[model samples]
Target: MSIERDHRRAAIVALLLTALLSLPLSGSVLAAGQATPATTAPSPTPDPAAEALDRAIAYLIEQQADDGGFVGFEGVSDPGTTTDAILALKAAGIRGVATESLISSAIGYLEDAAGEYASSGPGQAAKVTLAAVAAGKDPTQFAGIDLIALATAPVATPAAGTPAALVGPGVYGDDLYDHALVLLALAAAGEPAPAEAIDALRATQAE
Candidate 1:
């Protein structure tokens, strides 16, 4: 009798399992279950890179001041860092209405500060120029000033009729980093860097 009872119980369990398995479980049913139900499916595994990017973007957004510029350790709204952030977002291909508004406000700040930027060194000017160009703004006409021209003004041009590298300090900034950065920005702006600037940068590499 006990053996018969056990066989009956097992058959009932198998029947219930078969009924559940045979139910019309379509993809839509699974998707709907996954979408609203915190239960039917296993939770999706979070991507580490995506999570990190979200955190980084959030941090950057949080650092923005009312002027739409980011602040440095000095707690002062710095155009340099702000430009860095803008270029970063542009490079990452981030998009949205909020992002566009954020970038626009930052550009507005740069525009208001363009006079001071015009008077700054080539390195600083080039940074602003790149940031402006990346956002589809005209560096030549930004704030009624030609940022591209301003950026390249300090670079020495190759002596007329000569393809020789410039002697002495090739760039106006404190080091070659400025030279490289300015050259890159100039290229991005669709402006050719001075011949001397190119030669000077090339000259840095030992032959």
Candidate 2:
């Protein structure tokens, strides 16, 4: 879909993003030429952006439930919102045993709930698929579910009153957004989108 002549630009941008996101919450700023102290005080990152990221991450961690899932507006663990949190944390480039455990818990939560959330809606499945890929999990084998397959699964027939010609064999969801997200998920998973799905997507374009 990109028309850019220089694909390297994408790599450059990703590098920049990773550099920007690799902010540590705190660091030990010892006095000049001083020996290590028995205990060190917390020194916040000097960069305002990094400081803000620290706070944001703290807040996010606070939102996690005992089940390792993040709560949405409903104040309960939600699969979609947890998926979003996983992606965001991965983008932040935060790494540690605790963070990995948190991610593992979130992944477990998604696994436990994938049956309800990703079972039918391609949009939702795509989101989970993308999250799995981002978190270094297998999108195909995640939670014993093939998220890529779920994302590419065909939609059911349109309502009886709808025109027979309206439904496309490659169609995966209710609308174009779902279709596009599924395509993105497929790309992320290194899987090929169905030819009919690609054609169906192209058919939705307006001149």
Candidate 3:
């Protein structure tokens, strides 16, 4: 999964570089051609971005395990890593091909591991929810758990002056990563995020 993520990151960088290069070329072309072109520039060469994306997809396919899950550094198939692989494949526009089979396997792995993830933490639930939503699955019914609810459930707040009060209500006692992921998951799932939670996150940034 890490490998897939790294590959995806590289693909993005390649795309950015391609865009930057195209900008100067576009200006030069306009300057050189004041009149309409006699012929269509003989079909421009293959895009470097597309090539990079193809390479990334191939690398991801090679890393897929027998069970459809992309094994992580731990040499185990877990929901987190599997989800990462799925998202990376989707980003590369690799659906409806042999890659789809790999994605299906990863989904199956996540479904089977739902019970374990449910008890993990809000962060895990948020990430899985985002993955499911990205793959066109219903986050509410994923792994028989309402992942959105699990990630957004409000935490009890202690009275003012108590140590627990420092965290604030509706923050879930989770760190910034959890809060940001929950917000991202909510957006991906097309659900409304709690305003209090957003406010709490904003307050934390001020500190």
Candidate 4:
């Protein structure tokens, strides 16, 4: 299957797990005016959602490479794909023995790729920031670059009737995806997003 298909499946699995986890446990609540004796509640049946999530986790674990990264497009091991897998597993509450080693390896790969990611582009920087935050690393110190700053850097626009270009603070691309991802990364890093960036993104949306 394609990487995009895999991503969609992973998202579905995470959402299923989230929904399953939100369900109330099988138990009885006592009323304000209690009866003579409380009745025993039936044992909870096995949850199909939990079972599916376990299978998904196992599949993800099997896909993990020796170097700790997951396969992306064209079967290439990529940090972004690894990050997505890690976040998906996390969302499903699949940790401990089932995912500990996988998570550790992926984190190591991301840390090692920090420099390359920082030099790539704003999108890459945003993705790295998200991954770093997910792995409990500080984005400001990752690969010796402030990923948040790199992602939020403003692009230079040519000024009319002037030789000098004007540079302003905003998302690097000022496009929807770049702005949205950067904002997400900033939120994940516990940093406050700039109001101007939010406004800029909002203005670009189709009415």
**Which ranking of candidates, highest TM-score first?**
3, 1, 4, 2
Candidate closer to the true structure by lDDT (higher is better), 3 or 4:
3
All candidates: TM-score:
0.68, 0.66, 0.68, 0.67
Give me the runs in candidate 1 sitting further than 4 Å from their true place.
1-43, 94-98, 155-174
Local distance difference test, per candidate? 0.74, 0.79, 0.73, 0.72
Q: By the TM-score metric, which is better: model 2 or model 3?
A: 3
Give the better candidate number (2 or 3) by lDDT.
2
Candidate 3 has what TM-score?
0.68
lDDT (C-alpha) at residue 22 in model 1: 79
For residues 31-133, write the lDDT of model 3, one tens digit per residue. Answer: 4327646665587899887777778888877777877777788877767888788888776654333466666778887888865775577778888887788
Which clashing pairs does model 3 show? none
Q: Tens digit of lDDT per residue, candidate 2, span 80-100?
A: 899999887876665322467
Cα displacement (angstroms), candidate 1, residue 3, comes to 37
Q: Residue 44, candidate 1: how far off, in angstroms? A: 3.4
What shift in Å separates residue 1 of candidate 2 from its native position after superposition? 97
Model 2 poorest ten-residue lDDT run: 157-166
Q: After superposition, how far is residue 9 of candidate 2 from its true place, in Å?
A: 70
lDDT of 4 by residue, 93-135 (tens): 5334355556668878877876786656666788888877766
Clashes of 2: 0
TM-score head-to-head 2 vs 4, winner: 4
